[model samples]
Target: MARSPKDVSAHFSDVAEVYHDLRTTDQEPIISIKNQLGHLLYKPSINAADIGCGNGRYSLLLPQHLGDRLRLTFADKNRCMLNMLTKRLDHTCSSEVIQSSAECIPVCEKSFDFATAFNAVHHFKLKDFLAEMARILKDGGLLFIYTRTQEQNRCNIWGKYFPDFCKKETRLWKERDFCRVVAQTSQFALQDSVYFTYRRVSSLERLIEQAEGHHYSTFWLYSDKSFREALDRFQQNITAQFTDPAKIQWTDENTLFVLKKIREAR
Candidate 1:
């Protein structure tokens, strides 16, 4: 059965702590986004929001690149996830944590200078979320989406061991499909699309631990019997394929889309 949007949010709420513990902000993508934003002039106050900002991983990193003037809003539907972010960020003046879904952001339209959704778009009704983003962003405001396409997910190491992982995550958009969706929005123009690749080296034991902890939402969709069977197969594959678990490397690929809101005519 396909999980509804509410079910997806609930799953994240259930594993909020574990997800935060296992996830880290990828610095490479951060640098890529920072470079793209370099051409824009910095303002005394920059209004930014991170939709589905899980545990404030990316939010915490924004101040460095966006400067101290960044007033960030971290929005997520799961209260547990928002609570985690609040605790980690300590409710500073520079940041506000809001419990809201991406489909209907609670902010005023054209109020933000920048917006981002990091690996969170798949959880949303993409069309509504994109339109909401366009409405909320100031004219020329940038929206950055950092997510894995279905193709990228299929190429990951998890897909090799757990075939169902890719199959079950059919909600992920392909790159071309994503481009088409942006075109359909008509409120935003695609500025740039880039793929960032990184090598993730981990022990088979640790990888198994992450899977058991449901580090990725896809793992939450697995039935107990299926998860156990897949884990066993994954273990066997690792044992047969690699002599040393420490030497095992997985390729992590992420696609970033930089879109800018079109200015309204007076």
Candidate 2:
């Protein structure tokens, strides 16, 4: 059920044991999703699914916001990610972790009252994924997708400084792409598209360590030689642009596309 070896999931599987060690502990994107949901999940009892719930990062933090009444289903393509998540989920919440791809979820129809995909939509086949979501979500159910469009990617520190950083990554979908596809689905209506920019501060040494760890899936796109060259160039360029290497600051942008099921699956 795993994606191709070259896929980001494969890279993640290789480092699944230590993935958390390299990850930015507090991802603003995850926090933003919860913050947005805080208003909508008012029901005393709720059933939700975290599609592409890699390593259950969102699943763990979600209960604080959702409370014990929340029932969660975590689905992902990587078994390793699911396994890691299982060990961490003991008595955390009423949860189930399943290994499944986004385009085809092995679940009953209208099973989820709320569904979400965070920073993982790029790995899915959009048409099929949307249809699947439509099938699983009850009428009027909500789906929140947190992702960065290509334009946003270009503005990130890596894309600005690292040579070919944006060019090497082609998996991202633009805001218009999501809008058009959602329109075509006819099962759900795009509710809102919210953009967020977070100010990030990290030291140069920490930045290099993250880059060397291939903290982002984008780094795996380059060959060893190219990555080394880009890393050197990135280091030189950033240092030349700023005097204080100890406190490097940049802004990262992401978008959340909110959609609601307008009608039952066709």
Candidate 3:
């Protein structure tokens, strides 16, 4: 089951102290964000916001990639996440941290040149967050959303082997619906969409550790007893399918959607 807003916020807060250790970067978003930003016409300064920036997984390394011209704001609902992110940052880049939710960002209208959400949208109320983005982004500002769609989620190794993993993560967006929602808002125009597939190699023991640690929020949705049963089955399935417990391989896929603010929100 999808967790409520309060539960999700609490879940992140509970894990904030060890977020960097528990969460896998899945895909390095800095490369993708930097490449997309590079294609744009050069701007003297880029005011960017990393919404739902949990522990600064993606935004922390962005300053080095884009240089001093990148002004960043890290926003998330959990104060603990922002605090953890603060320790990781060296204060070399011009940045700000805001305690705010994705659905209601507290910032001046049309304030940002760009906004990016990586692996964070599934926790948001999609339309409300889109509306907030439309309100806060300047005309021509870009929005980069990197997430796993329902189809792409099914391709994950856990989805294939972990019992009911896919069925429990019902909050993911469908690709068609995702594009349609952006277009229907009229404040943004879809620019491009692409799929990024990464080959993952991990030992069975490591996978179990991550699962037991509840590295992903999806695991939090499972009851303790249910998760225990599933973990046992997941381990057995992996051992039976793979020739070597230490050399299991699979592909994980995620999508990136690029949209541009077409007009000012009324």
Candidate 4:
């Protein structure tokens, strides 16, 4: 069955409270992407918009590496996530939290030096969101969209364990083709980018716990019984895949695309 955007949005918002706590440890793929995004921002003063900035993860992390030279707006459709981010990073940096969908950002045109979204591009209206991001970014501004390449990495194995979740996840994600589409979009010109691959070592059980509340947990939109059954099946699969579940680990490859918006549109 096709997934509903509204339903997907609500599920994540509802679980935002326990989400970060359960998945505080990011896999290597996530870390690499975050670091690459930070590396791409080595410059002086600038303004950045963090679209789909769930709990302000990148918002808080970016400033640390980008130095204190940026004014950041952490935006998301989920108020719960934004509220948590505001409370967490209230006293640091120049930040304003706004609740808005990626398809339609409330900020002004050519207002930001950069815009970024991590692991959230699949949830956005690609064309509309990218165009809006391009419109808001100043000339030569940067746009970074990052996502996991294959879902089976041990970091994401929990989702594939359950048939219901596995099926949903497979459908919800875009493969390599979407990357080309994004690169060719009229909103921005693809710029210099790097693809970082890394492996994260984690136990099977921990992966399962993280899967329950992490970004991919949108599969929970299924009925409680369905979700539970899928989780059960997933657990079984994990046990089968690993001899000593505690010692077994998996690796994931995630990609980050750094794009530069052309100041003059044709």
Candidate 5:
């Protein structure tokens, strides 16, 4: 079951603490994420925004060579994540923060140079969010959306044995189709869709911790119990399914869609 807005808010509020520690850059997933986003992240124009900037992973990893070139905004509905992100920055770049939802960003039309949303697109109301992204960016601006592919898995054996979990997770990204709709309706051009594969070896404990940090442990199947107990069951199910293999091989693959705003016909 999808969490109620209140519950999701509360979980992320608690999740903000130790968020960076739980999903450290040392993790394999981080390597994959950085490689996908490497080029698009230059210094922003005078204005930019990071929507759904949960725990600010993308905010923290903004490229080094760009140097204090563009004003930046970090926006999220969860105060906890925003607070954590605020403390993480080094204070060199020009930036501001906002508490807002992606579906209805609290910004004026054509107000930003560019916008970036990483790994959090699935959480928004798509039609409204797409319109909001289009509304906030200047003519000829850009938006970068990146996310891991559904095929990536923590335990191949278990993913093969019990595919329902994978189905549930994969379904969340069906919004990718809405990207096309957004492009057409919002007067943006589909510049390019790029695929990148990244690999790193991580300990099982670290892998579980990263998953828990995102609250992936609270799938619909286990939501009736406390999140802790649900987590145990989630771990147990995967462990039992992959019992023959003492240590499982995990892979994370991602796709990025680059969209550019074009001047709408006058």
Candidate 6:
């Protein structure tokens, strides 16, 4: 069975450093997410919150996109992750860090102009988290959610090589389901939904190292025996299919949902 969100958060605290190292790589998909956010509206003295802001990767870019005009609050359930983020920012004046869960954000109601969650929603209690987001967002405020839907995950290169990848990621919401949840709230209107594709090419050796490191949360759920067996199969498959271990390629597919708060809560 999969662990509860609280348990998962605790586990992440233990592996925060490894998680940061694996995810902070100069990947094209990550770059694209940042670029897309840059295209959105940014104004002077705007307040923003990044929920579940692991290691502050996406939040760190907001300053560059919105300049000193942006005041940011980074929130996460994991204290260790928050501590790492604070150290990374070196306690910048423009930002504050809070240890809070997504279901109950520790901020005043209608306090933020913008909010974001990158690949973190699957771990949340969806209904409660969305309600909290609705409560915290100012009228006309925007919310950006970037994640890989179950459909997209099934199409990933890892799914092809590791047979259990898709099965283990059953918690991920489909694109249609995500859209419906936002629309059903009647508090947000869908502004835009975009699908992005990026190609990642890396040495097979490096890929195996990432797998062994349990870079993804899904990998953490696998038992030791299952993880080792999967890795062995993945390596064998790569060796048999590719002529060179240095030229392995994979497709990364993601969806970015842009939503606008349309009206004040009744």
lDDT tens digits, residues 7-85, model 3?
4446777778877886567545667777777545288788899999989988877787778888899999888889899
Expressed as tens digits, the lDDT of each residue in 205-237 for candidate 2 is 988988988888888877777788999999999
Candidate 6 residue-wise lDDT at 238 = 87
What lDDT score goes with residue 124 in model 6?
92
lDDT of each: 0.82, 0.82, 0.85, 0.68, 0.63, 0.78
Give the runs in model 1 whose Cα sits over 4 Å from its true position. Answer: 1-9, 39-41, 90-93
Tens-digit lDDT string for candidate 1 (1-266) = 44443245467777778776676458777777778775453567888899999788776788777677778888988888887787788544487778988989888999898898898888889899988998899998999999999999987878776647888778889999999999998899999988888888888878888888778888766676777888888888887878898777878889999999999889
Clashes of 5: 1
Candidate 2 lowest-lDDT run of ten: 1-10
Poorly placed runs, candidate 6 (over 4 Å): 1-9, 24-42, 91-93
**Residue-by-residue lDDT tens digits, candidate 6, 1-266:** 44443234456776677777676333443455445555344454778899999888777876765667778889998987887887789544388888999999878999988788888999898778878888999888788888889998887668888858888877789888988888888788888887888787888988888787667778766776777798899899888888889998888788878888888647
* RMSD, every candidate, angstroms: 2.6, 3.1, 2.8, 4.0, 4.7, 3.2
Q: Model 4: which ten-residue window has the lowest total lDDT?
A: 24-33
The C-alpha TM-scores of every prediction are 0.93, 0.91, 0.93, 0.83, 0.76, 0.90
Residues 1-266, model 4: lDDT tens digits: 34443256466676677766765434443344445455445666768888888887655777665557778898898888887787789555788888998988888899887778877887777778878987898877778777664443334554445565545564334445666776678767776445555555667777667655544655555665566677778788878887988875654556667787876845
- What lDDT is obtained when candidate 5 is compared to the true structure? 0.63
- Range of the 10 consecutive residues with the lowest summed lDDT in candidate 1: 1-10
Give per-residue CA lDDT, model 5, range 115-164, as digits (tens). 77877776777677777888899887777777654554433422443335
- In model 3, what lDDT does residue 49 have? 95
Query: Residue-pair clashes per candidate, as listed?
Result: 0, 0, 0, 1, 1, 0
Query: Of the candidates shown, which would achieve the greatest lDDT relative to the real structure?
Result: 3
Better of 1 and 5 by TM-score: 1
